[model samples]
Target chain A: MVRAEGLTFYYERLDEEGNVESKKRAVDHVDLHIRPGKFIAILGHNGSGKSTLAKHINAILTPAEGTLWVDGMDTKEEEKLWDIRQDAGMVFQNPDNQIIGTVVEEDVGFGPENLGVPTDEIWKRVEESLDAVGMLKYRHHSPNKLSGGQKQRVAIAGVMAMHPRCIVLDEPTAMLDPNGRKSVIQTAQRLNREEGITIILITHYMEEVVEADHVFVMDEGRVVMEGSPRQVFSQVEELKKLRLDVPQATLLAFELQKRGVRLPDGILRNEELVDELCRLKSKM
Target chain B: MSIKVKNVNYTYAEGTAYEIHALKDINLEIPDGQFIGLIGHTGSGKSTLVQHLNGLVKATSGRIYFNERDIYGENFSMKELRSKVGLVFQYPEHQLFEVDVLSDVCFGPRNLGCSQAEAEKKAREALHMVGLGAEYEKRSPFELSGGQKRRVAIAGVLAMEPQVLILDEPTAGLDPKGRDEILDQIESLQKERGITVVLVSHSMEDVARYVDRIIVMDHGEVRFDGTPKEVFRHYKELEKMGLAAPQMTYLMQGLREKGADVDADATTIEEAADAVEHWLKSK
Candidate 1:
């Protein structure tokens, strides 16, 4: 659903006189392609340009050089801006910032209403979107009164109401508690699995990325690694060098391997690790 | 030096239609020079309880004693209490306002009526403690990275030389490496200074790795309080409260459930690895 070719973006630091003092490349010569209806994760440290790259998907920030296409439409095309945004709805880090309406239902309906969807269709979309995110029961509750996870689900519903082909969640779980994080991640997974919506999740948490169909590790404004979850997480040392981390289970499995226990690489989940250990025990 | 809370209850908008009991009859004792993890889900009253420790929010009905002195007693100095009990708020980078990093760190000590030289000395010391050296002194706080800006904000609080430091989700938005750097700096600073450190966090792995004691709050009450292993043993209960044990704990439990002989109480990665190796050797 998304493709980029040598995408380069830089922020110009202006001096006192409005002249460019220096240019800092936030995303440099990055080439990546995200297939339709797949769960994708982008991992990077702070200021590593992951967010800068994600902004290009929704046409929020245009590339200074090279090009990015969302669903085959070039993001730099002004006429395609709104359509590109409609194709890839963006959910930001802070739920409080994205949510604008006082009530949850009203908030979810705002997007469809903006698209000039009829009032009846808008209400219909709101119900379906909220139901998809499992927030329909809270339709009338004040957005401020909801928990962080609930508020984020409402935010996702707002984006889903736009009928985007893909959703770009930029660190959506950064501010959430453990349960909140789980709920949000599960919501994203369900949207990808059941709704066939492409999910591009940018996050610092490694656990959230383990289940993704593909993973991209970015550092210093470039894609340092790209592969399946298992393939990427197997290189624990490389990920660490990029200032990222593997999931705890994977780390534990790696440590066991170091200590002379025969364990497979990139153990993504707790059950997988347990099963592998048990299989080893059976051999013993 | 030490803090004691007795029968503390806090209600927001009391006597109004929106009255909500944020905290309920909370009781605890924090001895000096200890690392404590204060954990709870959002709106679980962990923040409310920490605010009470530093006298930022007064309990509706309770008493607090700091260093054997009743904080609510007549002639008690709230200002003195504040300086001694430093609070580093969430997204503290937003609290940075001074023109330069050094000036920002010095703001706290200077406000406490220290001479300029003394304040600069304290600021430099605090900056060094947070791993920011003189090379960062003249740089504007606004120009620093997210992690650096957060460190400067923490330095602002540390400059006060507080005996008790309370951090509220200090690593909320930071990346994995940045989170580790900040937490490690705090850990070392706590050990060197021997000051009581209360880290309020949502990451179970961090709390298990760093703090000596874990206090679990739920519904405005202390649900569980013990060492990491002790509290994480109640992971089922924690799950019900919108919390969880570290991933290693779950892995250990999963191993045991699958009929493998393993210590399920292991909370950290190192501990779990040791347990698994021991089991493997026995086989």
Candidate 2:
């Protein structure tokens, strides 16, 4: 589990004189608690500080004015930075930037190797991790030659090899196609379900968010709304005002509701909407 | 310009130890001003085929013609071909290194020997085409949001005023709003400028919704090419190739199997809605 209290981050800009000319808070007065073993989706428009919040979960960016703890380890402690990162692995948006190893299997093993895991066990972890992300078939191939989706899966496998209790994926599917996106989401879910690792998926795709047990909506560097996906997406107007869109089916269903059709709220999938319409027609 | 590719065969690093038959005996014709959606799983030779369109890469065998002129044939300058077929690579931002957004966008036009002022004007217009404003010109590319930075990179290619624009996953690494904006801009560009468009994407739903024609590739060969409905009709085979049919198409197919009188060819939500409504009214 993770906890934050009044966390704030400032990006300090200095003039030529070496004095801080100004400071802009990227994350402002944010309080959060991520329960262990839950698949949570964080939704926000760009520059909403969601990425900043994700960084805090893994101690990538320590809080400037507040406190954060990962699994009871304070992130502010210098020695705990590595421990924090080990406890909650971070997967960034760009797979090309994170992958250092030339070969696929080697890339996945780099994390465990860096952690001083035994050589025999490192390969085992690497294989398991790659298999988890469906990248094992490409284990012998070069990372540079892989597709965006494959490379990202390798990145996830690299993080998985670290054996973190939780994985913080910052826009993991942003660069992927719909197939890649689905695979990545399914992998994250599998990790959460099978491996019992906590998952924090930060993305802007409303359809992907529908499957999450908990959803947090952020705007202007604050957690503006937090609830289940149905609870969050049911309020279509508020999401729209926040510059976010509901799932397409949900939006269409909402539009139909406004047109005097009594469809249910928070229709996540097209099948659900179709089924609802079919039932309505049966009554006639 | 129309492109006719006949039995094109290409291999990366051919004769070398790492030679990959990235493309094989592929033949296709891109009619003038046609909007083509190129879809495939990873390593399906989609990238290889696009490179041949603008002469970025020569086919190991076979010939490419642009309106009866051989692509590799004399009298067809590679520079002219490049200017005609503008390719925006997948990670376009990797190529940007100028001091400001304006300078970055002008890089392509300036390289083509346009005057500084002319390149700057082209940059401005290109930025506008991608929905960026003149105010973006002064800002540092790194300081802007990722989506904004991507638009600047796209504008750099658009500034060349290419007749045939090819985009490789232009909406990659963007949010939904950003994706919608980019797709809308591409759609408008195809309509307003009447430019030939080749959109390379992995999203079956997006391609099914927008593209006039869909080309499916598998293992470095053209597996299928036709309208979206025609390609998606082989839903089982596409799935076997690690691809998915569009959601609406899948839904309609499932409904028909469930005996719900839905049209399997309905690809978009609007079309599906209309089809379902019509079916319901008939019932």
Candidate 3:
């Protein structure tokens, strides 16, 4: 379980007069909780503090005020920082920046190696991680020659080898192509369903959020909304006013409703909208 | 102007021990005034292909023709090609190094040997083209937001007055609103300026929405070349290649497979909805 209560963070920004500003709160008095074994997607515009929240989960940055607890372990404890990071692995945006070793397998093993897993165990972890992401065939291949999705999978494998209970992906698909995005999402979903690991996906893409179990919407460094996919998407205009937009299917449904289609609210997927339309027709 | 690459083959670090077959014996033609979308997984030679258009990379074998003239000759004026075909690299904003936005935009045209006044004028015009106002002229490029800085970078390229503008993932890091703004601006430029556009993107959805034609690449080969609708219609092959149909396409197809009357070939969410409504009424 993950719990954050009244969390606040600040960064200093200088003013026009060259005097240091008091503080800029990247996240302010935010309270949130993620139950174990659920796919939670975090949606926010750029610089809206979703990434800040993500960094908190992996203990990369501790809260300046309030508290955060991951699996009942206090994030403020410096001694447990490494374990916290291992418990909640992070996959950053740039896949190129994450992968270090020359060979794919060797690079994946680097994470476990740093965690002090033995040489043989590192290989075992590497194989398993690669298999999880479906990149085991490219184990011996050089990373420089791999596609963006393949490279990202290798990055995920690096994180997976650590055997974290939760994976926090911060705009991981932003730098990838459509193909890369699909493979990465599928792998993350599989890991969540098959391995029972929790996924905290931070992204701007609306479509990516459609499959998520629960979602939190952020604006101006605070959690303004949280609900299932249907609940969040149902508030189309509210999201739009916050500089956030719905998936194309959701928007089209909203438009259809506007045109007096008599569709129900909170249709998240095209199939649901399709099924609803068919039902309306049958009833008519 | 048109660009034609015939039997092009290249390898990175060819003579050295670390060689990569970046491109195979490729043949393709980019017609004048056509908006072409290029898609590939990383290392699929899409970047390599665009680089050849503006003479950024030389083919190790075969020929490249610009209109009726062969451009791969030894005496090629890469300088001229740079003028005719402008390439906006990924995160083009990060390449902005000048102190002021105006100076930054002028750098490209000035380097191309335009008079200082001419370059400045073109720079201002280009800035306006990307929707920047007069007040933004004095601000540092570094001070701008990610989306604004990207437009500035594109303006810098526009100042060079290229016949074809090649954008590589121009909307990569943008939010939805920002992405639409950029894509809409690109579409307007293509229509108003009538410049051939080569859009290098990974998002099939973005390509499906904005571009007229699509080229799919894999392992240094052109796997599929067609209109966006035609390309996305092959859903199984696309998935097998580690690619995804646009979200709406996938959903529509999945529902169709499950015996729903939704048109599986809808390429956009809006189109998918229209197809559904039509089918519903007909039923």
Candidate 4:
């Protein structure tokens, strides 16, 4: 679980004389609360501070103004840093930069080994983690031989090996193809549903966010909107004004509604839209 | 100028244990003023095949002809070939090293031995084409937004005035709005300049909506090459190769399976809407 109050972060540019020439508030007075065992999605444009806010959840960036707590442990406490990080894990966008181990099994074991897990237990955790991500068959192979999607799943397995209560993924599917994207999202959902691990997925993909239990839309360093996926996606114009988009089916339904077809909003999936149209035809 | 590939075969680290047949015997022709979309799952040799277009990677066997001249033949100017066939790698914003946007864009022209004035003029034109203006010329390329930085990188290649432009996942990390903005600019620029454009991407929706032709690669081979409708018609085959058609196409297919009389050829949302409206009217 994660909670924040008036969370504010500033990025400063120093002049040649070491004085702060200009300061930009990357995250401005954002308040948020995330419950345990729930899948949450954060959507935003490029400079909307979604990634900046994600850093706060994992203690990667401490609050510059207000307070943030991960698992009830204040990130500001110096001694609690390790405990906070142990409670929450972070995955980044680039697959190549995060992976260090050459072999797949060894890579997944690095996190637990760093946490001082015992030799025998590290292998056990690695096997379980890789199996959770459906990569157990690739245990002995080099990670370099895997595809981008497979490499990302291995990254998630590495994070899982640490046994963190929450995992924060920052645009994990941005570098992948559609199939790869589906594989990564399904894995995350399975982690949340079956394993009860908390998931905070930060991405720009509208379709991927449709399956989330809660959706938070951020813009210009502020939490502009927050609700269930249906509640948020129904306001198509508001999201469009914020330079974001709803799922394709949702957009199509909205467009059809504008043409006087009298369809309901928040149609997240293709099957839902098709069924709606078929019902309308039957009524006619 | 058109590009012709004849029985091209490319092997990486050939004759070694680690050798990879990155491209198998491929034959294709790309005409001038055409827009192409290259789609493949990762490690499917799409990147390997594009590198051959600009002479970055030589073929292990077979030949590539650019405008009827063999690229591997003697007296063929690789330098000229590079300028005339610009290829922008994925995440090209990392390659912007110059302090300011204008200088960064001008680097390609300057490297080609153009004078400062000429390079600056071309860079200005290129930036303008990508929807930037004079205000961005003096600003640091690093300070711009992600979409703007990508546009600046594209301008860097555009300053060379290439006859053919190849972009590998140009909109990879951008948000929807930024992706649409960049793709729209590229589309208009291709039309305005009449240059051959090859876009390598993973988004079936984007490629289906914009490209004139679609080329599908699978395991170092050109599996299919045709119009977007033709390629997407075999959506099942594509799914087997870890690929898929646009969401609209799938929706239409689902409708037909559900006993609705919907046309399955709709690749875009507008076309799907029209088909659905027609069906509703008939009912």
Candidate number of the best DockQ: 1
Q: Rate the local accuracy (lDDT) of all candidates.
A: 0.94, 0.87, 0.88, 0.93
> How do the residues A1-284 of candidate 3 rate in per-residue lDDT, one tens digit apiece?
78999999887778899888778789998999999889999987767888888899988889999999999898999998888989999998888899899999999999889999999999899999999999999999999878778888899999999999999998889988777888889999999999999999988889889999999999888999999988999999999877788977788788888767898888877778767766776797
Candidate scoring better on TM-score of 1 and 2? 1
Tens-digit lDDT track for model 4 on B1-283? 6899999999889899999898999999999999999999999999999999999998999999999999999999999999999999999999999999999999999999999999999999999999999999999999999999999999999999999999999999899999999999989978988989999999999998899999999999999999999999999999999998999998999899999887889898888888888788884
Which tens-of-lDDT digit does each residue in A1-284 have in candidate 4?
99999999998999999999999999999999999999999999999999999998878899999999999999999899888887898888989988999899999999899889999999999999999999999999999898889999999999999999999999999999878899999999999999999999999889899889999999999999999999999999999888888887887788778778989878899999988998998999
**Residue-wise lDDT of candidate 2 within B48-108, one digit each (tens)?**
8998898888999999998779978877889988988999999787788999999999999
Summarize candidate 1's per-residue lDDT along B1-283 as a digit string, tens digits.
5899999999999999999999999989999999999999999999989999989999999899999899999989999999999999999999899999999999999999999999999999999999999999999999999999999999999999999999999999898889999999999988998989999999999999999999999999999999999999999999999999999989998998888788888999999999999998894
B-chain TM-score for every candidate = 0.99, 0.97, 0.96, 0.99
Error of 4 at A20 (Å): 1.5
C-alpha TM-scores of all predictions: 0.99, 0.94, 0.91, 0.99
Candidate 2 segments exceeding 4 Å error = A102-105, A120-124, A127-148, A177-179
DockQ of each: 0.89, 0.40, 0.52, 0.80
Best by lDDT: 1
- Note the chain A TM-score of all models in turn: 0.98, 0.97, 0.96, 0.98
iRMSD value for model 1: 0.7
The CA root-mean-square deviation of candidate 3, after full C-alpha superposition on the true structure, stands at: 2.8
| Candidate 3 true-interface contact recovery | 0.55
